[model samples]
Target: MNRIDGGFGWVIVCSAFMTLMLVDGVLFTLGILYIEFLDEFKEGKGKTAWITSLIPGTMLTVGLGFGGIFLSTLVCVGHHFEKRRSFAMGISLSGSGVGIFVFAPVVRILIEEYGWRGTLLIEAGFILNIIVCGAFFRPMQKQSGRTTEKSETKEEAIDLLRCDDNLIYIKENCIPSDKNCTIEENASQDDDVHASKQEIITQTKSTKNTTLSFFSRHFDFGLLTNPIFTIFVVSNCCTCLGFNAPYVYLPDRAEEKGMNKLDSAFLLSVIGISNTFGRILFGWIADRKGVNRLLLYGTSLVICGTVNVMNPLNDSKIYLMIYASVYGMFIGVFVSLNAVILVDLLGLERLNKALGLLMMFQGIATFIGPPLCGKSYVYNLY
Candidate 1:
């Protein structure tokens, strides 16, 4: 940690942010292309739906698994500094929201002027931003502090001098008040020795209970053992189950109500605009007004939005627009609440592991949510 406070870390952050934004933008906008391919390829029912659905499957399932396994290592980067941790996380987190802000209009305009194929090409370019971002993501280089041979020798002498008076005693035996203490003194007097013994015992027990692999810590089921943690996980899973479907299907719904394709595309941009506002305003309210209560209010808004969406007031364009705007606000709240709620539940120390696992499970929902909802819509229509 002492060796890493320098220029290269920030460079890595910027590069990683750019690349992640591109990949994430592609994932978010896949829904828009689902309908396009459905029409263009003349696919029927479930087959046509796979285009958008398939993409996120790779992201959610594969990406999440890898993230969970490596999260312990990945989260270590933030441990070196106290002040920069939140700022670093917030900076990274804000990328997805920023991606939404940047790409929403671009998608709208491209789909408006050219078509879906053009939009995919544009999304591909956005994905390439990963490369740009990756360039800056260099591993932290060790910056050793300056030390001459004389200073090194002096430090060693000082350490020896400090140790001379700090004699350690066993339960029944007295040790010398100098560096000449024996293994018997270590066994009796040293807390570090006791700690090491305990650690060895723990590893032995763990090995007895589980298989013997070098990377024996292959999984962490300790997270799911907590009841409150389990409940939040389930709630988030259900939330994702219904949440993304509406956004993905909204354009189609608008068009079904006799809106033009261009207008339908524009509606998504409007939602993004409203979502940006929703995160900022509601995030502030959550902090000031109580995060839990504010979250309940947001969840209530989601329920209301869902019910509003089910309305047959399709002919009333103003009512439809109003619903869309409100839905955007509700979803924005939902998205922001995701991390905040996890932090509230788990606290900062375990947040990365909790989030990694939470999102891995949520990824299952993300992968399955839209398609299941889409399929249900078809089945209900029949």
Candidate 2:
């Protein structure tokens, strides 16, 4: 059901926006949680960080942000608009920035008042709204057109592309047999109906099996056969190694450098606010003629890396704020066009599978990145 720059499409954009806000809000404020965990558990930073790493898939608390709402939102936007996809993606994903802005200070205060465990419970409440947004992710609608089958012998021919109880919708609208037009003299419509029903059941079971395998084991290995895809995947893997470390450690680092917890958490808000503007600005720029999305993405990533590397030059709050703003803007550009750049490289047909595979790699990098950052921070501390 593609409306393609239509009215309801904006509704979907809004849903995506809110979804990201909740998902990333919980995920990005881990720094607030990090301080609490250390104070409560009396654990070393490296070991404590493995706790943060466990939240995504293992813990019920951080699990809200973990279920790939981030990827799913992008895929949902992909289904609706084409020409303005970059712009739509920007708006939807900018919710991450919004989440960071709203959640960081809130989480810090909650931890200070409620304890980390209490804070986790309330944060869980914040994340559950993602389910409400999930309602707006309308499924693809069938194309409308009338077709007469070559089968005067058949009552109905159904191309059952997919049939599942969870998503109960149907294409191939049934047309009743006309009063004057009958099948052959002896033919029974009842037999055809029964056959069609059996076929549908068979396809439904097959679809279930195929979908399970597709999510788990099946992928178009052919996509990896392309040299360009291989290079792209490897390059992204490299880029992601340093990407997530800062978020997990930034607030804690600020606190260590003698800033109060509130001020440290506010740094994430600065990053988030800057990130929001960056997503919008870069997304709009990508829409203009002659703009190279790949080049823009690469440049932004390079700049972000530079900022991350240079962040430790001073303990000054103003300098840290400047660093946060610069890093957040480029981070926005990277995310805004991430899938857009992929579409240019791989086209829409392959996006769903391609993105899943891409995220699998990036997720590995994300999980490894922060803990390794913790190890470095631990080393530097001693």
Candidate 3:
């Protein structure tokens, strides 16, 4: 496999960018929708929160499980690029940031001009573009020699059958031939043939059993036993516990603090801009700087967590913008580097299963996080 990095891989990136733009753009901009749902449905904060959280939770959990567009894109890009894998993934993942930047204002404007229901309809139209994006993922070609080896193996089996005479002799003897063979000899030959047939049948049964067992061996559930991978999953789930609450509620929080809708929406744009740059910057660094990716990822998470925890303290618009900017940048770093860091930890061979399981766990947290945050808000728990 020669990886043609520039030719088709870049096309895949462009498609992936668009896919993420539509999917994540709508997902992140749900903060705008949060307010709309509150008014339109006349629901309490806790009840309304499920409406927004369901999109991401379903996509991450069920979509990934069944091979969603994003997961398929990631797998394609990983297959296509090796040396520049981090950089390519950074660019591809940065689409979510760009989508957040671009869609936040667009979604707010739609809500203002057309109402929340209209905005949702328009967002659905945008999301349909992922189908177009998916078409660009050309299937990778198989190795040339693989088919040849299979053919050769078949030919060898055929030749061995052709050279064998015992079966042919048995078949010939079954017909009425005028040969001077004794009845005793014929009986012994019949016994030998029946024993050989039974042996072959037994071997065939065992081969089927072995084939079934191969899947379990190859998938290797023992990966969960590794302390590092286990710890990573637990920590990531914890991070998801609060990962989306800010995006969902930040705009409302700003409105409560006397910031207008437009200004609060722009905060997401600020986050998007910084996040876009952070993804590209960290990706470039990971590729060329030889830095420890886990350390970099952890540092970004710390910064993001700190910014989020301090979010309730700032009431000034400018201060909020600054905070949003810092938070966005580190969040971008965390998102862009997530896959690369996993590859570093688990290697590429195990990455698909590792990521699938990770997303499944993260999805559970995503489903629960926003509702909890909304309930907290109802009770002034924060």
* Highest-lDDT candidate: 3
Q: List residue ranges in candidate 3 displaced over 4 A.
A: 1-5, 64-67, 145-220
Q: CA lDDT, every prediction?
A: 0.57, 0.78, 0.80
Mind giving the per-residue lDDT tens digits that candidate 1 earns over 203-305?
8888777664422354345889999889878877877676666557766777788887766655665655566566556655665533463456457556655
Tens digits of per-residue lDDT for model 2 on 228-346? 88888887778766776667778888998999999999999999999999998899889888998888888998899888878888888999999999998899987788788788899
Count of clashes in candidate 1: 4
- Go through the candidates in order and give the C-alpha RMSD of each one to the true structure: 8.4, 7.2, 7.9
Order of candidate numbers by TM-score, starting with the best: 2, 3, 1
Model 1: residues with Cα > 4 Å off, grouped in runs = 1-24, 64-98, 108-118, 134-219, 289-312
Model 3 CA lDDT for position 308: 79
Instruction: Answer with 1 or 2, whichever has the higher lDDT.
Output: 2
lDDT of 1 at 136: 43
